[model samples]
Target: MAKIAGLAVGMSLALGAVATPAGAQTIADLQAQINALLAQLAALQGGSTTTTTACSFTRSLTMGASGADVTCLQQYLQGTGHFTFSGGATGYFGSITKSAVAAWQAANGVSPAVGYFGPVSQARYSAIAGTTGGTTTGGTTTGGITTPGVEGTITVTKNPSPASGVKLYEGDSMKTVLGIKLEAKTSDIKVERIRLDLDETGDTASQDSAFYNKAVQKIYIMDGSTVLASSDLNSSTVVEESNEISITLAGMSFIVPKNTIKVLTVAMDAKSSWDSTYNADSWTVGLATDGVRGVDGAGVNQYGPSAAGVFTNSFTTEDDILDSATLAISLNSSTPNTQQVICELGTDNDECDNLEVAKFDFKAEKDNITVTDFVLDIVRAGDTVATATTAYIYDGSTLVGSASVAGTTLALMTATFSDIDWVVPSNTTRTLSVRFDIDDAALAADTFVASTDADDTTAENSVGNTVTATG
Candidate 1:
């Protein structure tokens, strides 16, 4: 059809050129226009002239992959004289397509020439197809249907701070594990699907099944805090072939306009409880180079970079620390304790009893916690540790426990009051007052500092699970 129209236009131009007056318009300029039109027509008819064909190849094609992209590859190869098969552009990559690809690769100086149309071959073809005249050293014009609108290109950059070496404890929900940035170059891009490549290390077949069944609760594609799409990783949404997992986002509507960047985050929710003994394993998440499926403003499918080793994020599963309930400890804000105290001189070096030093408040979440031990550290300024002889822990007016501050060193001493066995009910706070007994040998400005830190106190929940305090 294009050739017929070109022929009619050329005939009219020829007749008009002959009938024109000599001085009205230059005969040379008319002939030049006619010649240029003839050249373009010949290029369109797949002649010796080379012309750029508007076709975009977003995916690497090999044997067995069938799509419009493959058909485009075949048509371009046929025009380049590399594909000589009788059955032309069947839209399926068969043995003939392989042969044609190998020939094209060899002609274009692509190494090895094994007929695998990968990133290197795609890049080389793109370079040739993007040239002004669409002509290369050994190839003629590319023949294919001209795709309408601008040629869209998507660049996928791996996130700089991908979550790595993370411990995904039980009950961890909606944790972002992998991310990539997508930039649309020439047109708006509508991202419809994303493919995740799963790599499990030290995982058995049953463990893999367990992971898909219950370990991973849901996988989500997030834009900041908004969810674009989510899947439960069941058979309906996921297809597993070899080491790759393809997730289908059929109804997703994530769009990246031209000259803009959109961040795509992959997050997953872990089940609150899983069989740690059976399903614990390290897993790495990545995007398959051709897995990011989307369409540009022109409604052409776009893919992420086909380069290998671009994205990688690894995480391991571990047993949860808080099994029954959470135990939190913090410095009591309501306590009237002061760090610096002025000791009154009573002739014989000031002796102070029950000097308030530190106060701790412990809370149990959802379960009763019996605090079994409290570890205290006392530092005496400008005096020996013996100046602070004893440290007592009082629950209001009742002395729960006391320890002698004579262990460890002279200036700094550690006092462990064990077997206190103070029970704090669920959702209740337990405040313990820490007091020090200062001997009369201390100077006027001397001070006894008492403090405690997280993980220094131990407690057991109602279900008999031992837990360390956390703020």
Candidate 2:
């Protein structure tokens, strides 16, 4: 009878650990799992009095998390000499609570001191539960906790949110924000910084607007409607590996959530001159690095259009793109009415020598187009052959100095000019004056035929001297 009684006591003690039939792990594995198992065991013994430990926490806590779990976490931290919530643990996991959690994590030698109560932290908590400020401090504690900034493999696609690609002008004032849409596929990427790479010679003069400002020295980045980050971007911040401008958010971490559309508008600097190469051209905005301020560099691969999700917008021109270049000849200050002129020195060569024969002027009505070369079509008019008609052209802009050329015959004379160094300014006018002499020639009647204005645009119009009979 004594042996049987001892055996029964041993059996009861062995069955104590059998409270959880699904393995030997304590209730720390899962709250629901432990509860169901414990409840089933209790019913089997006809409502026998058997008490099991309850869960203190069952959910994860993060930066913006606020609930009973956070309250319990705060209490535990305070008890463990890791935190002193000045607000007295209000159950809100705000910045203060995050700091305290990070402090505790660092104290306990966690890999990253982020205030995320993840699986590793929860496992550690389970190992030290029920102690002074341990896991069982004030609430139910459990696992299945995931770390922040490590959500998963994030993908970014080029989807310029709110509108099309950015359009910026040269010498534009600062604070110009470009709404670049980014579609985060399966989010979880903690985009810390955005670096921009621009080609040095990228302006296209597409919009007839000059004064290009392309040297962006600083910029601010926005995540949705919130201004998440900003950084001073300049020559100093160029990444040596890629030679790009890196802009990092100040004082906060910007994480891309799952299945969300995040717009990263790059508000460039107004004080500094932006790089002209970025005008009407394409550039790159890459993801962050491991450090604070910018997006994680590894995340660049997760974005589409590859090449770090480069941005580009093509400018389209409407209507006929015509440039008006006018070169007109006049006698003195009179506007040109006739198309032809001949030196009226029939028998008086002295009159031709001292006469102010003609005047020429050239003007441009367009912007920034290089003229490879220009020509002036002239003809020594009439059946009479005269080659002594010498002309000199003087530039009013002091650009062409003075050029002298001999006369050409009537078979459609062409005066080709090379090395004509000049740039066409939009809506700006430039002029040249011409003086000619008959040079002691005694011809019956000769006319000097020439085109009035020949430019990069339109057909060559004629304005020349026609002398039927010399006066």
Candidate 3:
């Protein structure tokens, strides 16, 4: 797309006739050196020249018109180059004077005699004035006349001068009107709308107004410019519009099938999660509800001693006390023992349940019990059973060890005596304890059944006694 080779220079004038004839030279000194060599070839073909005389001949013309019919066919075919006018002299036969009268009637072999002027174009303007040589009005030598001069006018203002200008390329036929028409494309050619005034400092003229649907196949419009407006947009239904965003026909539907591009992205507020203000009491109030009856104060166990031994009862009152309970503590000694039960509930006073009933249950047996020194005075309680109650130490149901009790004796206590590590669970005969009781209202300890006056049913002297094993 780079062409600029226009350097034409040809000047001539030699008409002779008068006076004492040295070498002659006078038809007014050869028509003033043929109007100063046709005004220096109409200022070097910027355009203009005309003159015509028919019958006895006389011709001189230069025509290459562009706007306002280049001053009306440069004043009608300046130096009448035997007729060639398509645009200038703004007599508007625009299309660069029909491509310079179809390139001067296909370089004079004829046939483009279409519009503007007729009679085979005035008989090819009297056959370019009978062979162009100019001069006559009596000193007659009209043999086949060809004076070819006197038609003058040339005006070319350069700047993409092929008339109305337009040439962007890349798959050209942008829907027609002399084709290559454009609504958008900064890279793949095709573009119009006053050539976007030629890149007005890069986008943002309010984003150039809008109307670009050119049947969209791959449009990115804004700056990255990657247009392919339909070669049937492949890769499964392409529809990529983006001055910031607009996409349709994504995975496949109306057949956008050639090389695909359906991308849309531009809602930038960091990436929107939407909170223009968000209402409806912000999600109504914790949601899921139902199940309350501590003597029915309506929903969430509403206030005061909500049942489960309302005040105290070695702990007993169940409907799954909020669904999880098991608190067993037995300690009967017949001399084959190891004992430790430091279960404390919380509300702080070293917690054993100082009325801070949010939840607790205890378990203890070998939370750290390993006594095997002499074997016989072991009465360890808590064999796997605790949902919450601090004092933890079990091995049969896995808790392992913890006992530090004194937040003021756990506010009011029901279970203390903190430290112990008794391990004697081999041939038990007494000591079968278990502990657990979840929803507490301050220690109402239950699930305890002890037995010691020794009938010796050995499971290690009955660990905490209740011996019953058969399997």
TM-score of each predicted structure versus truth: 0.49, 0.32, 0.13
Predicted candidate 1 versus true structure: per-residue lDDT over 1-471, tens digit per residue = 866675576456546645876632554444444444443443334422123354677777888999988877877776665555676678899866765676566555565454679999888776555432222111222222222123477888787655587666777777888887898886666666777766565554443445566556778877777777777877666677764555654555566766888888888888777775634577777787776776653346888868664677887776663564778988899776555565443334465577778788999875688899889987776644237778899999999999987756666788899999999888899899998777765344566677788767888987678876787
Give a tens-digit lDDT track for model 2, residues 1-471.
644454355334335535856643432223223222322332232221111232366777787988877777777665444555456769888866765665555544454555678778776665444221112111332121112211234444444442333443333333434455554443234443444433333345332112112344455665444555555554454443443333444443454444555556655543233333433454333334322222221222243335555553222111111212233322345424444344556456433642333454444332333333445556665654544344444455354322344434334554445555544344454444544555434445565554434342122212211111100
TM-score winner between candidates 2 and 3: 2
Task: After superposing candidate 2 on the true structure, give the runs of residues whose Cα lies further than 4 Å from its correct spot.
Answer: 1-153, 161-178, 182-191, 201-214, 223-226, 242-258, 270-471
- Model-by-model lDDT, in order? 0.68, 0.43, 0.26
Per-model tally of clashing residue pairs: 0, 39, 116
Clashing pairs in 1: none
Judged by whole-model lDDT over C-alpha atoms, candidate 2 comes out at: 0.43
Q: After superposition, which runs of candidate 1 have C-alpha atoms over 4 Å from their true positions? A: 1-149, 203-210, 278-280, 324-456, 460-465, 468-471
> On a 0 to 100 scale, what is the lDDT of residue 152 in model 3?
18
Shift in Å, residue 162, candidate 2: 7.7
- lDDT, residue 72, candidate 1: 77
- In terms of lDDT, the poorest run of 10 residues in model 2 is 462-471
